[model samples]
Target: MAHPYLAYYCLNISTIPENSSYQSSLSSLLSSISLYATSEFQFNKLQKFLNISDPLYGLQLCHGDVTTEVCRECVATVAKSLAVVCSRKLVALIWYDECMIRYSNESFFSTKNVLPGFALSNIQNITELHRFDQLVNTMMIDLESQASEVPAGSKKFKTKEANLSELKMIYSLVQCTPDLSTTDCNTCLQEAIGTLPVCCNGKQGANVLMPSCYVRYEVYPFYNIIDTAPSPATGLPPLPPRELEGMMNFFFLIFF
Candidate 1:
């Protein structure tokens, strides 16, 4: 029994300095740092979003389906690890919960990478492989249609339904960089969906992610709370998003 509310968000950026000015490059990278934090899940309080400008190139996206704590943790982790991994690549991707942070010299918004990034599974497998596979196929079809129909603005969405015995649910989350138009986000996600069969195969859970977008499926609940005004269900400042299911889960990402 894992905690159902354990979602997070992160942003990662990588840049190549033509003149190799580390100072300016570092400043640009740090500009988006403050923009990443927020007060989105304070029980009674409203979700407070932070919007700060950066000196260099950057973009931020929260999956709109997670708690503030998880969001903060994921962003903090990327902020800490980005420099070590990217090391002046001028571009990078840091994957975490349901959301991600990324930036590059060349904009990736509204674009599909089709680079075949990665694919893997947990050690465990379902007892009924055939039934589980069939269910997953049906679930993906439904998710694709729903997500395709969501209004463009952020392309940050998470969806789930009890697939097998009702007790076992199928969950997923998908997102694209805010910098991209809605259509591009949709396009990127479609590309990701195409690889699910090759990537995760018959595994219990898995995720497919690119710098701009990603999709995931698991057997357990893996999203945090969202801050909303109680009475009217009034909307608060927009927060990030994340969701996962079964043993699989959402992937928070940072891009640069």
Candidate 2:
């Protein structure tokens, strides 16, 4: 059976030079992800050397809402997929509904990257198209502010809903990797939100996933409602519901 998120997107950026040592290093990195990426912390960064000039740097993250078990299963599935699909690549990034895996010969931690991401949107457009677009834009911008606060990093995620009318509501979420500075997080979110007009304007919902951050808004209550209390110390963000896991079908607009 196909993995829950395999149908969404896979990015194979650059290929590594053919060599036995690189192969061994690849094995090491993949093994590390399966073992360490699903700990209490949902994010892990890895840098390992294999008696070679360059070392492999990797980052793995799961959506905050998933359990550790789900994170492990997702990572294992992606590791197996990378072996077959990105066999010769030195640098690759693969994103699933619940998790993302990226490795490179160079460092990307704490840096802002908007490329190598994809946007997914619903096929049905909103009835009050223009007004709905305005609401979405404003809602996402507000969510971005609440999700990127510093300290123990607990503020790097937020989920909120706004009433459009008696019968309509807009639920949205925004998140950034804890490694990013508040400035970078805001910048990254701005770029992602700006793409809505072109990628998801008028749509009933949209999700923009990037290596460093993610933004999503839907008409219905897609995510589980949770407390928004700020943490006393910096830390990982709270887990939201895993609604995306079952949303395998959507229109994809990819960015390379």
TM values, all candidates: 0.67, 0.83
Q: How well is each residue in 1-256 modelled by candidate 1, as lDDT tens digits?
A: 5432222222334445544554355445644453455644211111112233322354444555656665666565655555555555555555555344454554454455544254434435677778887877777656666665655443345465445664565555555544455566667777777777765666777777666666766665444313211222112232233223333433322222
Model 2 residue runs over 4 Å out of place are 1-3, 6-14, 17-19, 152-155, 227-251
Q: After superposition, how far is residue 143 of candidate 2 from its true place, in Å?
A: 1.1
Q: How many angstroms is residue 9 displaced in model 2 relative to the true structure, after the best TM-score fit?
A: 7.3
> Against the hidden true structure, what lDDT does model 1 obtain?
0.51
Tell me the lDDT of model 2 at 80: 76
Clashing pairs in 2: 15-90, 16-90, 64-239, 151-234, 152-233, 152-234, 152-235, 153-234, 153-235
Model 2: worst 10 consecutive residues (lDDT sum): 229-238
Best of the candidates, lDDT: 2
Q: Count the clashes in each prediction.
A: 40, 9
**Number of the top candidate by TM-score?**
2
Error of 1 at 242 (Å): 17
